[model samples]
Every structure is written in C-alpha cells, then in structure tokens.
Target: MTSRKAEEIQHEGASGGWGSVSGMAKVLLREKPTPASLDTLLHQNKPHGFMCTSCAWGKPKHPHKFEFCENGAKSTLWELTSDRCTPDFFAAHTVTELLGWQDYDLEMQGRLTEPMRYDAATDKYLACTWDEAFTGIGATLRTLDPKSVIFYASGKSALEQSYLYGLTARFYGNNNLPDSSNMCHETTSVGLKQVIGSPVGTCVLEDFETCDVILYFGQNPGTNSPRFLHPLQEAVKRGCKILTFNPVREQGLVRFINPQNPMQMLSGHATELSHMYLQVRPGGDIAAMMGMCKHAFALDAARREGGEDGVFDRDFIAQHTSEFDDFAAKVHATTWHDIERESGLTRADLEAAADIYATAKNVIAVYGMGLTQHVHGTQSIGMLVNMLLLGGHIGRDGAGACPVRGHSNVQGQRTVGISEKPELVPLDVLARQFDFEPPRDKGMGTVETCEGILAGTVKGFISLGGNFVRAIPDQEVVETAWSAQAITVYIATKLNRSHLVHGKASYLLPCLARSEDDVQASGSQSVSMEDSFSHIHGSVGKRKPASEHLRSEVAIVAGIAKATLPPNPTWRWDEWTADYGKIRDLIEATYPDQFKDYNARMFDAGGFYRGNPARERDWKTETGKARFTTPTVLSAVGVGDAPGRYHLITMRSNDQFNTTIYGHSDRLRGLEGSRAVLLMNPQDIERDGLHVGDVVSLVGDAGDGAERSVGGLTVTAFNLPSGCVGGYYPEMNPLMPLWYHDVDSKTPAAKGVPVRISAGKKPT
Candidate 1:
C-alpha cells in the first residue's frame, strides 16, 4: 500500500498544548500589564469578569479556573494593552499615507485615546473634543435625508449599547440598521427561522455531553473557538463519535490537547478528535448531506419493505414535522452520480457516514460559514435540519442544530434590534415605550448598505465598533462607496483600516472596550450579552477606562441621538443611558417571554438560558410544525465557464479573528512573516501548468462581466480537494464582486467564488 501520510505532507498542529500557553504568556508580556491585569485576563470569562471579545461559543455553566482560549487571550490583551494612540499619533499620519500600512501595523498602534476629526485641507486627523466631533457629525447627518443615513453596529457591543443604537436610528426616522450579523450568520438566521420559526440553534453546550455523534459540516473549531475543544475532549473521552466534513483536513478537528489540563500539558499527549473525516468539495454541503440521507433513506425503505419499524421516525414526522413526503421524494430522486460529482465523495464513503449517523441514537449537526457563505446557503441549512428531523434527533438531549457564531455578542446585538429588517413586535414595543413610531420600511443590510453608498443614496454612515471597510466584500467598491459618503463616524476603541478609509467628512469617537469600567449615573453598569446557545449573562468590566477621555458606547449613542433628534419628553435617552437597568426593563417589556426578569436572572451564577421552542419540541413554524424543505441542488452553479479555473474560498488564518489581524504569521499553518500566500492542491497546480512558490493572479468569474483581480499571491501545495483553492480574505476580497452573494440572505459568498489562477511573478 502506498503511504500517503496526511500529517507529513500537510501542515498540522495538535492545537492547545504548551504552545497555546506559551502564546498566551507572550501576549501578556508584550502588553506589559500589571499583576491585576493578568488576573483580570485569566478571569475574562468567569462569572463576574468581562466576556472574551472573540467568538460567541457559550461559556460553561461552571467554568474552570482558566477558561480563556488562546485567541481569547490575544483578543483581550490586544484590547487592554498599555500602549495608546494619542492625538499626536493621528496628527503625525495622514489618512492617505496611513492607507499604505498593513492591518496589523495599524491596529498595533494601540488604543484610541481621544476623538479625532478629518481635516481635508490638512489631510490629517486633527484632535477634536467629543462634543465638537458629535456636533460636526450631527450637522452633516441633519443636512442629509434621513433615509440616506445608515446605522451599523459591531458584535462587541453589549445589549444595552446596541439597544440604544437601534433607538437612535429609529428615532432619527431611519430604519437602515446594519451590523456584523449580515456578513456571517444571516443565512443561519434566515434559513432556520423559515423552517423552525426561530433564528437560534436548538442545542446548548451541554448537548455535546450526550450526543452520540457530532457532525461538523464546515466549522474549524480549533482556530475559530478553541474553548469549544474542552467539551469535544470530554465527549471524545466518553467514546463519542465525531465526523468532520470539509474540503480541507483541518488539524484542529483531527487532534487537540487541552491546554487547561495539567496532566495533558505535562504528558504532551493529544486526543484524536474526529474518527471519520470527509473531504467534501467547496459548495458541496447540500449534495454531501443528500448523499448521506440517500443511504439512510434506502435503509429505512428496506426496513419498511420487511415490515420492520423505528428506523424512520414516523410518529415524530406525523406530529412534529410537515413536508417530509416531498423532502423524501426529492432525496430519493437525487442520483448517486450527481452526488459524487457535486460532493467529491464516492457513494460507498457517503454510505459509511450515513450508516454511522443512522445507528446513532442522538446526533448533533454543527456548522459554520462554509455551509452558510454560498449562493444556496439558506437551502443548505434547511437540508441539515431536514436530516436531523428525519432521524427524530431534534428536540432531544444532545441532538439538534448548532451554527457556531464567530463574534462574542453577534447574536446578542441582533436580539437587541440591530437588524436592518427589524421585527414588528420589537418595533411596536419600541413605539409604545418611547412614544414614537418606527418606520416600517424595509432597510438595507451590510451588502445593500454598501450598494446604497456606491449609488450615492446613502450619505452618512455610523458604526458602533467594527472594521466595516475591511469586513465586507469587493474592497475597491467598498472604498469607493466609503469615499462617497458625506459623513463617516466610528465609535471604536482601536484604530483599523476603516478609520483610514474616510469619507468627505469623518470622525473617530473613542469608546471603552468590553473590559473597561463604565461609570454612569447608577454606578458601574453591568451589561448583558447572549451567547451562541442563547444564554444571556452580565459582563462587568474589571479594568478602568483605557483613557479618561473615552466614553461608554451607550453614552456615545445617546450623545449622537440628542445632537441629531429634536428633544422629546418620552424618548428618555438620558434616563436609559444613565441607567442600563432601564434598558433591561424595556427589553423585558418588549420580549416578555424570552427575556422575562432579564436583569435579575442575569445576576445568577452562569446566567440563564433563553428558551427556544424548537429545543422544547414545540413546533412553531407557519405550518404549526417543523417544515422539511426539498431544496434543489445549487453547488453545480459555482463552477465558472472557463477551463483551468478553481473555486476559491476566502478564509481566516489561525492567528486572526475576523478582520482583526493579530499577526502576519499563521502558526497553525506553519507560515511565518507573511500572509501573502494561497493554498492549492498539487494536482490543481500541475493541471494549471504552475508550481509551488509561483505568484498568481486570481480573476473572479461571478457573471458580472466586470474584471476583478488580485495579484502577487504565492501559491503553495496543500492537501486540499481538487478544483478548489484557498486565499486569505480582506486581501482576496477585492476579487469577490459585491453581486456574488447568497440571494436569500444577502451574505457575501466568501466561501464559494469561481476564479481562474495563473502565474505572475516569483516570490522575492
């Protein structure tokens, strides 16, 4: 037998061992924090400590002494650094010149200490008082039509800040509220809600304990959420089965050593994570799922033919689901040939996976952007739900859907009404509570917001903390759209690419980080945030403000609202901003069932879980039952017409979180000193008449007829599936046209873009 060692050929790392601990220690040392700072950093996710501002995986009910992950340590230390970006730093650099700096360099300049405004004449950001900045922003916004202004939020903000942000936008007579959710999990929300009548996942963290099988459709949990490995480790110890389906063999899913375990750290022994791994092609989740179901469906048919029972869950389908007949018909009609062609998996391989899934009493289907950043992302989510419903796995302990969220409070921000298309119930509640009617007009999401800016319809943009310009697709188009804006305001803690990509009039209003104390009229405030599993908890910052000039996001939102809107008695912006408890009271009054006793319950140990009807086996869909969807195959459309073209999926390096580049090196991928490289299969390289280390230019083929390309990316042979290559995002984002996005959810198809690659230059 030919020995094709997976680990030797491809770069791999058993995540979370001494390496993680050393990395964490280095980050703390580089930040030069005090003993108290180290203490606070270690307790970042504990009961009273501030939440880690990284991924949104829920914290354990009983957290260990050290629950922070490697990335979490980086994120918090990055925020709590002693270095400061004072007004002198801004006065020394021009926006035009600063644009040439790399993202990591820009962020490493440290936290923003004061407000700064763009002076077009001087071409530099001049120091300005908070009042001056807000007044100027308000004046520019007031001059434009309310519909031309868009309010955006980031996932870092607490629920109180996001609530105030929404109210500010609505009271200003605009509904164009967009946020980070649109860029990542909008498909999860849109698809799950259409089928299950809710946007959240049905399973909690405890489900991993009892789940017989864990099916990872696309997520790479090691880099995305390292803390998630603890539970998976525990599950593996119990001999639970883990199946991973992705285009690449992610090392994090293959092997992981718990950094928190002293014995494991001392022994240097790693736990094998995935027992079964499938290299599903990019944009192949739908067909792969269908192929697995095809085998299960056949087994159920044979059992029925033999007059046997219980393989198909007939009772659950009849009582808790609808449209199973149509779903089954479509599943049966999908041939194995098409499945193999689309999924890049043989029928035998899929059947083996299917047998494992079918034999398991309880299974959990966990996925990430790989399944949600495609043209058919919504349909793909429905397919996963259908598979779970087919086996009667849902509504049971350790069995349901789990879409891993990438932001700390992305879900929580949406829960507090940071949506462009705000629901009517919240609108009605706000209208009654605030003595004003919110506009019912459908608003622009993240992509649409950029489109509006490019079209000159949107004149003002306000972000409550995000690198908006770097986060979206079509970098050139976004830059043009941002330059066209009349005013661009950012409430942020640190400087990033978005701060340099200014409009005709721009302002940077410095704000406190999640780890900073927010002193208000009611004393230090504790803000609430909802995790990926719908658990709401209070986050109280341990450190003092990074700077005395810095203000809380709540105060900034109120300041903007007071400056822009006419004074109204019922708006009560002052009262709400002064006391966040009033905001919680309003949230409770708005969503009584979901957030009943919101503030009081949040004081409990480990917080409280906001109940979901789907998890409780209560059908809440339009049909009064969980609806099964018969989705048409859509992966075939991802292929470009041109030959020698490979499908490109932009991804994050292990060192980075979202657009915030922690460093240029990706330690997990074994790349150092630079991120200007592409991972390609050796077969694809030979077929394209190219070699490793050859610089290549990628031209996107999204049927837009516009030429979009990025050059000077070095290609390296990787253990990836054929006809698929990988590129780092925010750099390759220019190749993704604004039009190439999921139709239903409006999320950029960052995971599936057809591209033609060719050699350009040799690496220096």
Candidate 2:
C-alpha cells in the first residue's frame, strides 16, 4: 500500500489522537481524481532535497528507509512545498499587509525567490539586484560607527558561512555577535565555562549505549530530540536505569515505539523508558541536585565509618579535582528540611535517587532549557557538575554531563570562534593567521547586545538566520530597538517576524537552504555539524536549489565582505568561499591539537570526536583540577508571590522547537487548534475557585507602571505543581519583564515569572 495507507494502519494501533497522521489520512481518504490529483496535491520532488529546519530531530547515526519524526516530517513537507514567494507576490502585497498575517501563515507562503529591498514610500518591498542590495548595505555600514553594527548568526549556517560572517564582522571592528544560543543554552555555556573551562558537552553519542544509568533533567527527548529516544530505548532494553526529573510527565520519557523499526511499528510494541520519574517543582533543579549530593555524601561517610571504601571515586577526586573540603562541608551543612522545602521533593525521594547513583558504575546526566532558563540557571548547571564530580562520574565510559543543544550547528558555531569573548589562543592565532591585530577587548553577548541596541550604540544588524526579534525577551523593547536601526540585513531561506520589524533601510537576502547543494566556483560543498556528543559530522545536501538566484550563506557573507571591507592581503574571502576545505585548514591551524585533520576526519565514518577536558578527567584550570563549587545558599529560591500569586513557567509544545512551531498541535498535552492555554494543578484550580476552560488574565509588570497581560487563556488544570502555571513561550514571553534575568548569565527567568491569575474577561 501507499505511505499514507500504511501510516493510517499504524496510527490506529498507536495511542490516541495522532494529529498529523489524522490530517494526512483525511487528505488521502478524500474522493478526487486519481494520479493527476495526486500530482497536483503533492509538491515536486527535487534531487539533493530533504532537510527539516523545525526541530533538531535528525535521522539516526545508521540510516533508516524512513527516519523522521512527526514534527520533522511536517518541517520537510513545508520546506519541500511547491509554494513560492516571487517578486510579483511581494509587488501585490504590502509589508504592512504581510505583518498582519500569523507567523505560521507568513512562513507557509514559501521560500523567497529573490532579493527584496524595503520601500518606505509605498510601505512595500521591491525587487533589488544582489549587487545593489550589497552596495546599499555596505554604504549603510560604512556610514554607521563600527560598534553600532550587531552581527547575529543562527545555527542554520554552515561552518564556512559562519566563519566568513564572523571574519567580516570582526574585520569591521565590532563583536556584537548574538546568536540562537542566547535564547536556549547560553546558561549552559556560561555555567560550564566557569566550572569546566569549556562551553560544550564532554560526552559522545556512543557513551549512551554503555551508560549504567541516565538521569534526565527537565528534557523531553521524544519531541526535542527524537533521535536520542532510540538510543535511550536501547539502553533501557539493556537494563540501564533511566531516571527523569521534570515538572510535567512527558509521554516520551515513559514509553516510545520506534517508528523506524518495522517489527516494533507493526507489532505495536512500546519500550518502557524511564524506570523512575520525579516531578520536581519548576526552577527547583539546583535544590534537587544539592539534596541528592547531600545524601550521597552521607552514604559515603557511613561506608568509611564501617572501614570500607565508599562508592565515591577518591582517587579521581584527589588526582583530578579541587575544593573537595568546601564542597563536602556545604553539602553536610545543608539540612534535609531546606532541601525538601526548596525542591518540593521529599527527603526519601532524594535519598532514593542518591542510592541509585551510588549503585550505578556509569552515569550520564542530561539536561535541557528547563534547567537553564531560571534565575540561577548557570548556578544550577554548576550544581549538577558538583554532583557528578562528587561520585567521580567524569571522563569515563558513558559518564559525563550532556546538554542537549536545540539547533544542529550551535556547538559547531561556537567551535569555529563565533563567540562574544574569543579564547586567548584562538584570538592570537586568528590575528597571526589573518595578519591583522584582532581586537583584544571582549565584546557584546545577548544581554550586552540588547543594552547596546537600546543605548543607540548599535545602529545596524546583520542576522545570518533566526527570528531575533521574537526569540529575545521584552518583545516591545527589542522591536523598538530593531526599528531604530539604520540598516537591518536578514540572510534567510523564508520570511519570519524578524523581517517584518524593519529598520530605516532593511534588505532581505534570500539564501539556499542547508539541505540544498552548494555548487560554487570550486564545485559542491559540505557543512559540518557538531552533535551533543561532541562528534563533528559532515552534512552534504543532495537537493536542488529552491531558486536559481539564491546563494549559499558563505557566498553571501563573502559578497558583503567584498562590498564592505578593504581587500586584506592575508585573508582571501573569494578563495575560502570557493572551497570549504581551506576554511577547515584555517580552523585546524587556529586550534592545532583539537582539530588535527579537521577536513579528513570529518569525512570519516561517524566523524571525529572532539576531546572534552572533563571526558579525560583532566581539569584544565589554574589549579589543574575539577574544582567543586561550594553551595553557599541552596534555600534561596525564587518562586511567585506570598500565598496568592503563582509562578508562571513558559514551555514549548510537543509540535514546536524553540520559537519555530511545526503546527498548532500539542500531542502530549492533548491541545489542538491553538497554543494559548495554561496548565495548572487540579488542587490549585480548586483552591483558586477556577474551572477548566475558564478565561483568565495573567498580569505582570512590563516596565514602569505598564502591565503586560495575556488574556482569554483557557485554564486547564492538570498534574502541574500546586502554585505553578505552565504556558507556551513567545506567547507568554510578554509576562517576562526585561529587567528580570539571571544576574550571572543574563538569561531571562522565563520559567519563574510571578503573576496574579484572576478569573475574568481579558482586557483588550
């Protein structure tokens, strides 16, 4: 039978309400013409195609005939759709008219076919030649102060493209580089940088197979990273203990049927994933970890008292770690009462989790945005590291901290020197390699970029790819700053809200998608992506270009550099754009030991695994050891108001990844058609005298005396914490105050917004 018919048979056997499958079945079962109708309904299949930009749910390491998730499939279908945004389409519609459309609606319009320039007079966008657009952009940049320009790169760009963009920006004498990492895993980087002297994860994907125990913290692999689910499933089947700690009970964590496995899919057999589940309160991750560590220390002490060596790795601690006395003292000083109250988990639960860790020979701690989007997000990650260090879990088979990255190449971007503060060695090497004195002074991060923009120090923005306006906190302030820019250049595949919030002279430069072949003067090109496991793999596209006029991000950056920068004697932009191998050589030269044969190694099966200091149990610090950070105040919790208001935790739907929505459906939560809904505990609803589907207004201070409120939200009471409310982000981002951010990392406390929920009609 056809794919549609097979999917229908599978969906019937699968659990309740498969939205995408049901939607597909409706189209398939409908009566119409035969082959002709199918041809009309389906988009043209092009060679070198098939890449999903929506979620990071990639195909497995080993190939499968059908390897894609529900969200991934939707993203693929959307990317491969026949819809086209031609020059005539823009000529017919005004920018203002397009601004009125929904985010999903705008993107569904299809890939932009040509370069477009904003027309202030007609309030419309007009077609512009590539050279004209570049020249205009260059002129705007030259007019502005170098510090005024903000170069924002996304994870979608290739290594060559990202390196070129960074080169152009730094060469122009500014480092206001803000990327998608600012929104998702900036806290992880900041946290790990302070503790481990590195920003990326320390483990490889193969480690999962051998891990004795896997502890998941506030991450849902089934939706966020579906490819991870299979490995997790295999681990569970092999009797590896799987533990999950999150406010909500994610379905994927409980059990998942591998869609790619024919036997499993046909037989409807699902593997039980999580052996133990602990629902910790929102923003209480640090407390939970501290509690577990405290219990483990007690157990170790008891074992020592009995004249036997405890489970703790004393040799590793003495050889590879520092500040053990302080770390142990803090844990010993912390009372069980404080841990229970702060974590919202009982002493017994913490003890049980500690017991499991103590028994497991190999353990892997995995976390996501939930642990990194709080007031003390960075501190939370440090606490987790402290826990891992206590048990000597570092640099072993299947043992290390794994921070699941949202985007595909976020790690690779950071790897290729797309950082706010460049490392000393890289900076020195880049200067020597390019024959220019690179800026020794540090530059702007996400928070700093916002501050610069608002202060009018930043006058221009060149976004490689991303919805920077919508993704950042305080939408009103961000949009206002964006509008005030002298020039805002967006190099993207499709339209987003960022394109609508234009500057004085905005230009949208359409580029080829990542899955599309990049055939330049040098021939076909391949981009490298670093997975969460620190494996650097090559992803070459096999699909045809969306449009003939579209250029690769590398070429676009090169073109802009040629227009803007003076001809550099040392670096040749044209040569680098011609072949990505040349860029790899530069990268390898910059970091000699790390990327020895960067080009050749990337082409090897399974790619090259970058060395993580933590993985080697070799602490790269001034003291030459993994220093255990002392927990000064574990009870200093940031919750909502006193006995009345509840804390609002912003989350993403199952069908959504970051700010990119695959569709308007939350399969796990059972919500359909819309994303404007709040989840609360049934007890909280009863105590507050609220009912299901009751319209409520969530009010919070926007700034000054102004209050930002999202009204007309249906309150659906579920199994969430008593005093906590969970809602989707971007929609609920208005409730997050601009000034309210982590002091250390400067990441917005999106998970801990204090709001007074009331029963009434929402104010317009």
Report, for every candidate in turn, its global Cα lDDT versus the true structure.
Answer: 0.85, 0.74
TM-score per candidate: 0.98, 0.92
Query: For model 1, how does the per-residue alpha-carbon lDDT over 476-508 read when each residue is reduced to its tens digit?
Result: 877866787888998999999998888899999
Tens digit per residue, CA lDDT, model 2, 247-292: 8777778777776666776676778788888888877777888888
Q: After superposition, how far is residue 674 of candidate 2 from its true place, in Å?
A: 1.0
21 in model 1: Cα distance from truth in Å? 1.5
Q: Each candidate's root-mean-square deviation in Å? A: 1.8, 5.5
